[model samples]
Target: MSRTRIVVVGDVLLDRDVEGTVDRVTPDAPAPVLDVTGVHASPGGAGLAALLAAGDGADVTLVAPIANDPDGRLLTEQVEVAAQVVPLGHAGRTRTKMRVRSGGHTLVRLDDGGPGTPTTVPGDVVAELVDAADVVLVSDYGGGVTRDAELRARLTPVAGRVVWDPHPRGAPPVPGVRLATPNVAEARAALEAHGRHADGCGGPAGPERVAARLRSAWGCAALAVTAGAAGAYLADGGQVRFAPTPGRADGDPCGAGDRFAVSAALALARGAGAAEAVEQAVVDATGWVRAGGTAALHHRPGPGTPRPPGRAGESLEALAARLRARGGRLVATGGCFDLLHAGHVAMLQTARTLGGSLVVLLNSDASVRALKGPDRPVQHAADRARVLRALGCVDEVVVFDGPDPAAALARLRPDVWVKGGDYDTSALPERFVVEGHGGSVVLLPYVPGQSTTAILARSATGPRPDLEVLR
Candidate 1:
């Protein structure tokens, strides 16, 4: 699929995760002097919404404020993953939140920085990007990103297709937008501003009532109310559909709501039905945020190699079933990986990045020996499996005890087939097999010095390390 660019506008902030373990009480004034374990940073506010879009295969441009200060530097650094960032100078401080955690529970959170009103963004850039965007998402976090009337006026014209998480106090959008994604609270406010009957978070006119009213009030084609664990209320042409979130919605709800918004936008951009669209989004939201508070689109290099996008993966058949059911796509590749090196990681990452789940055709002990001769595959199959599983680019692992993974690929026909740069697509013996099932083949990057061959060469001249002893 070609790139689907999305423009996300509004508040952009930084999230500092201060994680630690608390063993004993603090010697300080009534505070737990917890032993800090580590810290991680993530993009918050609209930056997070942009992150979700980027993670879901959308070329996202974050059009938010960068105050041109130290905190602005942090916001800019945090949102470096986007395709383009529109910095709004003059807003002195970039909003930041530091959350203190203990035993996976957030004990306290201290917020730094404050909202700043954006004055301008490089010429008519906002309008141009909005016009070019396949989907536009408004993350009105009330962080002063969308406060300008002129900016809103310019942006409203190109709202042919937009998924808005509207700020409660922002001005009304331009007419003719396709969809508005709001929680129950913001829905009431937006709708009530147009003289409709609704209340924030859900009151007299709940989601169903507000969705119906907003469609006419703002000329929105559809409306979706993200009800958190109660799922979501989707309405189009006066018809309402309530899609419930998964059972695991009770998990860490840190940023899952933002994930749901972006995922829903992506699904709609892909032309999915409302319920189907929300289902995919909810899945992505709960899976990522519930697990690690990470946005869906991960950009980390594959095992420090030039791997594909979705390299780190899980079950193949299971993933395939989910994707097939929802029309999601996937890619697959195989390798011996007796020695995990950059080349192998790079190859797997690229394979997954092409799109969807990357099923690794693993070489069992016997298969590696058959292919690479004796004294190879020092690591046991189970140990190799664990190593391969650790890489984020690989989704599923299938161990073939004999040899040749074509039989395995035939069983699970992925949408795309990828191999390392060492071989041409023509030389892929199963290329036809994949094509027979309507799958395409591509060659991935080959990182030098990251090969088993290199390791073998180095070992020949010195004391060989028994890296496979763990297996």
Candidate 2:
């Protein structure tokens, strides 16, 4: 399947986190002295939204204004690897938000640069990108990107779904936007700005009323008002639905809006309805928060690492604990994968689309020999694992030594267990194990004529060269 093309156009900024430890009181003042330990930098605003979309396996393009400064250069370098970044040069310094933290708690936040006008991308360039998009996300961070009339006009006629994450200082979206996501504070502020009597929180006019009013005001097809801890209230047409969050999320709420917007946009790009998209976004955002929110961003390893961000080979118990803390869907599939083929790729990619992460359980050499006879497993377990790690669809790979994956399933406790359509639930020995953990088993479509057995058979009929496979 072709990847979904997403275009994110809005404000971009740089975020820096300075972490340290408070050791003693300062001699100059009575404040505690912080011994600096580490510093981390990442993209914020539309840049982050694009990164999130790209992380979800979408073809993303970010169009935003960046100043010609140190912070701007850093933001550009960081975001360019994640997506196709198109920079519109601005005159002022790029916005930078610095947070000082100690022992996982923020001491103070300092803001530098900002409240400045963002440079507008050329009209033709904006139109060209938006025209080819599967979904357009407008991340208005109270910056001047959305204030450009020409850009807004170009987005008005987009054939794809348009999702607007509104900011009070930013301009409203064009008419006919598909969805609008705003938190309770932003919703109340917007309503009050429009001369409407809106109670910010727990007011006589609840979130349902606030959502309805915002939907009409923005001329959007649907509106979702997010109330932290209380979930979100979605309003479409005359009907309103409340989708409560799974549990209370603990962590910084800074990037929650960006995560929510990108997830919803990706869902829409995949052809999900408005309500379903909003619900999925809520789930993703909730998981993001529970995983330490912005704190998780700093845990990534530096360059030249052997394994990718989520591809490390860990014990089943360790992996399960990490996934639970992360609070997203965990998908697992087991197979020999003796000779990685298109069918295997398709199954893995399909499994990834079913959840936030995909874990592949490979049959160890001993197990494959037991299952497929002595002449099976064209490739060794190590070689097979190396190849699987190269695929973008696979998040992690584990080799299990058993005829059935019941033991692995019991330890991992994955949320979903996937298999090819060729097999039925009753035929799978691990089906009961998965269901016992409150997980579902999914049978994905199988690609015919794309099996390793057929390839090996054809090879045997042809000239048999040295088949000294690596052990």
Candidate 3:
């Protein structure tokens, strides 16, 4: 499938995260001494949202100005790494947020904001980019970027899908925008600005109220209010629907809402209706949050699911504790991975769906040769390992020394163990190994006719393989 082109424009910022461990109070000032382990510079604000969209295989074009400062240099270096991360102008200093993490929570954050108005380079850049995109995503970080009237006017003539994530600055809406995603606080502010704040609770209180006011005042076609834990609500040209959050044993929720926004736009662009779009986005994003911020983990169900923690689960207690410390899930999936194709993608995403961690177990080159033939698994275990780990969804990969993933899962004992297609759930390989240690297994819905064997036969060397044979 051709990637959907995504053009993200808004306040782009750099997030510098410093991770450390605190031992005890220091004699110097009665403050704790932190032994810093490492520091990472990741994109934040609109830049992060756009980076994630690109990671999901979207053709992304980012148009935003970076300030000509040292922090801007940090953002520039990170952006340059993303080959597709287009920087519009470096005329002004880039917005940078410095967050310090100790133990498990963010202890302190220092933010240095740029002048909240666009410079000459950014203003001219947006006008040029808007003309070339297939869909326009106005990610207003509420920084000074979209404050220009000229930039707002340029967005109106956009001939493609227009999605706006209203910056929390209570800015008035421009005309002809199709969808606006606002959080609870921004929703409340927008309503008050329009003189439409009605007091209520739980039932049509915050976001719904704002949507009603905006749809009437500006003639906006659709609205979605993203509530952190309660999920999001959508109102289109006619009906209104609430997309409920999946009930996962909760974990740290970071960068999850942005995942929802990116998925929502992508799903809608792929022909999913509004309600389906919201639900799918919520499910996927919620799954990511529960996996400890990486978006590849899954956990046991929430407070009210009627079932037990099911079959071959991933994390055992020992491993789960370790993953929590590292801030990701322990994911394990097993397959030939020989001549990798669509079936593999589905399985990898499914394993991720189970929790916040991923570890792929590949059949060793020797093992593949045994299972297929002397000429099979043409790639060595090391080469295969690199290929799988390079996938955006995969975190770490190890080649199974034995024939299958049983030995690998036995040692790693990840929070979840996943298998592809329709193997009998009753005889699932990793069930007893994980469940005996109190972990549960989940059976992801399998996609038929997408096996490796099917793909090879369809290549130019042969006739159209009737995959119906697998059925």
Instruction: List model 1 lDDT by residue over 52-137, tens digit each.
Output: 66656678898887777776776676566454687766455767888887655678889877656676666487878888888888
What is the overall TM-score of model 2 with all chains considered together? 0.66
Ten-residue stretch with the least lDDT total in model 3: 303-312
RMSD of 3: 12.7
Query: Worst 10-residue stretch by lDDT in candidate 1?
Result: 303-312
Candidate 2: where are CA atoms >4 Å away?
A: 27-30, 200-204, 301-471
Give the distance in Å from residue 423's predicted Cα in candidate 1 to where it truly belongs. 44
Taking all chains together, each candidate's TM-score versus the true structure is 0.61, 0.66, 0.64
Error of 2 at 209 (Å): 1.4
- Alpha-carbon RMSD, each predicted model: 17.1, 14.7, 12.7
**Residue lDDT tens for model 3, 289-378:** 645552222132442221111111234443355455666556677767876677688778778866777767788888898888787775
Q: Candidate 2's C-alpha lDDT?
A: 0.80
For candidate 2, the clash count comes to: 0
Task: Give residue 184's error in model 1 in angstroms.
Answer: 2.6
The models' CA-based lDDT, in order, is 0.70, 0.80, 0.65
